[model samples]
Target: MAALQKKQSINCKVLVLGKSGVGKSYILLQYTAPPQEIVQMPKLTTVGVDYKYGTEKIEDTEVKMSIWDTAGQEKYRPIIQTYFKNSKAAILVFDLTDKQSLQDVRYWLREVKLQCGKDVAKILVGNKCDLPHEQPDQALIQEYCEEFQMEYIESSALQKINIQEIFVKLAKKIYQQHKASIPQNQLKQNSLPANEAQNQNSTSSNKQISLKNSKPKQKKENDGCC
Candidate 1:
């Protein structure tokens, strides 16, 4: 048998949007951190634009996720549009305990529509769900999701609630959408990783050893896109 090579990686860029101090950075921190590691989310705020990278397994394919975290402050708004181009999805985050953050997300949603295609995936994330507070208006949440084809999720980065699930959900959705364009022959041939050459007789061609919790080493990036 010919030496098998790893499946080609698909690059998917995702944009994270929300008001300042809404735990946008924290969520990304937890998502990239090792699953078993107890992460300490810092009191950090994005300035211009930042990038976080992680890989996920989508069936036999390996997906490289580039999460673009943009500054929510008004001064950085002018530069945010540059990162919006060709985004696979827009994650609109808000502090669940803060009504104002929830309201601001509507504006964020509008911003996404103006910059991205209608077909672009949008996810409404209510962060800081670990805190106690009055819920945002149910009607508004329903209306927001209805306005655009999107999914709603409540998460708490501090508590590591639903951090992993959100990325997996986004990756799977994006992969499905992109799958139609791939060449069938290429997909079939690259089903196995190069390191698995010893297991050439394995019948499950699409089975991949998941390294989801182990992220590749990368330097922290700010005011940049990856």
Candidate 2:
């Protein structure tokens, strides 16, 4: 039997949702290495969803991720649901300095769960970690993550602290889930037809052998009569 071929890389979409000024766009820009001019935008509100692409390796497979940064205004919330419909993963961000932003995280999480369903992978992020005075209550954040069974991390896009690690961890988690979600039967189904064709060839060879043996017996009979 031929060996199974390696699985192809998968493309995944990850949507970043949070309240305004929570640094969602910055996180995406840092991960994707967008043009310097774009990254230099002065803290402006995102009018609509912005898209970026990033790649990370997990378990010997390259995972190409499309990161979407959705606008956080209340008016834009309903429209953002459309983008979440086919999302494979999400990053829920909140500002460490603002307690209200932390509370808004729950709202964003609910929207994601409602639109993307519970099976969609999620990660919680607390941005602006480099600012000592603005740090959020880590204990509270940890408790929230524990309750939801979500991975949590703190990062500062300006300082570049844990910026890359966040993407790496999210990629790893999605890769693991993607591998597990594919059923063994489906993989077998993909390979079964090739094996069946090989068996058919073997059967044809056996029929040729039987025809050769029968011909020898006929030749011997003809020789005796002669």
Candidate 3:
């Protein structure tokens, strides 16, 4: 029989779902790599569902995440939902230049909720934010996010703007959720009994009084006189 390995870090699954050509793969690539290194890799694309592994430290604890970038085509929708099985967090990416892409995120959001349940943490990403000219309606996006109680942010994969912040934000939220899930009683460390501390103080005071009342033995000299 083989001995089981001890677990040191927590594992989290994060899903990136959006319409095709919304830079879902690009976001993951940029997040996992330096901007200068992956700058020329524009043609990178995920077919059905591509998995990327990355480790991030949330404060003192390390979190290993399997980031799943799902194909955004309608035909691949069924297959994409399967990857949502054990996802702890999800990012709904949309292209800033394409309004339809933003609107399509609603469908993906519904699918995520249905498949992954409502407890999964979700963040809305408006990618390609550095593009010139056209942009999604900020007010409308704010309304949607507020309505669904989802966090929203604008990111530019090419410019590397808010790229790292996205993951850090996600990691923080996931860590918080993990902490919240633990039983309250389990989170507290060992505590002394109600009277244990008070009793110790009382005992110390009695000891001091006993020492204070002790008198030098003069009885030995008096015994000789008896």
Candidate 4:
């Protein structure tokens, strides 16, 4: 039999949703380590959604992530909803420097729940934490997480702080969810067919050896009788 080729892996899609000017694009660019030009800050708004792909290794698994940085304008909300349907996870970013953006986290979370369902994995990110004077109260974010039962974290995309940890935590959570969703019985059933095939092949091999040995003995007996 010809050797089988290694399978190419599919990237996981993670939607980055938040209000305008909350550093969603920056976070993505920083994580991907794109060229300086691509990472350059853009003053213009994202019309629809922009995609950035990144790969990280967690233990033995290689996780490829396609991050969708969605446009936060009210007009583009509907367009962004389409991408959320297949999203495996989400990073709900809010500007720590802007109190209103912090308040708008709830609205983004609601949209995520509506599009991706309530059980979708999510991480609440408080961006611009380096400039604390302009940010909102950390207590308020904690209160919201307590009320909604969501994971919360603080980060500064400009300073490149907690950027890697945020995604690592996200990957870990998604991995756990994926593991839980798979049934143990289904896994056992899937392995059974391969095991049966191997056993059948072994039995057939043994029978062929027995037949060859019996043929030699019968030939010798016929010669002796003659």
Candidate 2: clashing pairs of residues: none
What TM-score does candidate 2 reach? Answer: 0.76
Q: What are the lDDT figures for the candidates, one per model?
A: 0.81, 0.81, 0.81, 0.77
| lDDT (tens digit, per residue) of candidate 4 on 1-226 | 3233233333578999889988888888778875565555556467899998877666545677888889988898878888887887889898877788888888887777777777666788988888845546778788767765568888887888999888988887776666567699754543355556566668999999988888444544565574
- In candidate 1, stretches whose alpha carbon ends up further than 4 angstroms from where it belongs are 1-8, 35-39, 180-226
| After superposition, candidate 4 runs with Cα above 4 Å error | 1-10, 35-44, 147-149, 185-226
**Which of 2 and 4 is ahead in lDDT?**
2
Which 10-residue window in model 3 sums to the lowest lDDT?
186-195
What TM-score would candidate 4 get against the native? 0.73
Total clashing pairs for each candidate: 1, 0, 0, 1
Cα deviation in Å at residue 208, candidate 1? 37
| Residue ranges of candidate 3 with Cα displaced over 4 Å | 1-8, 34-36, 190-226
TM-score of 1: 0.74
Q: How high is the lDDT of residue 66 in model 1? A: 92
lDDT value, candidate 3, whole model: 0.81
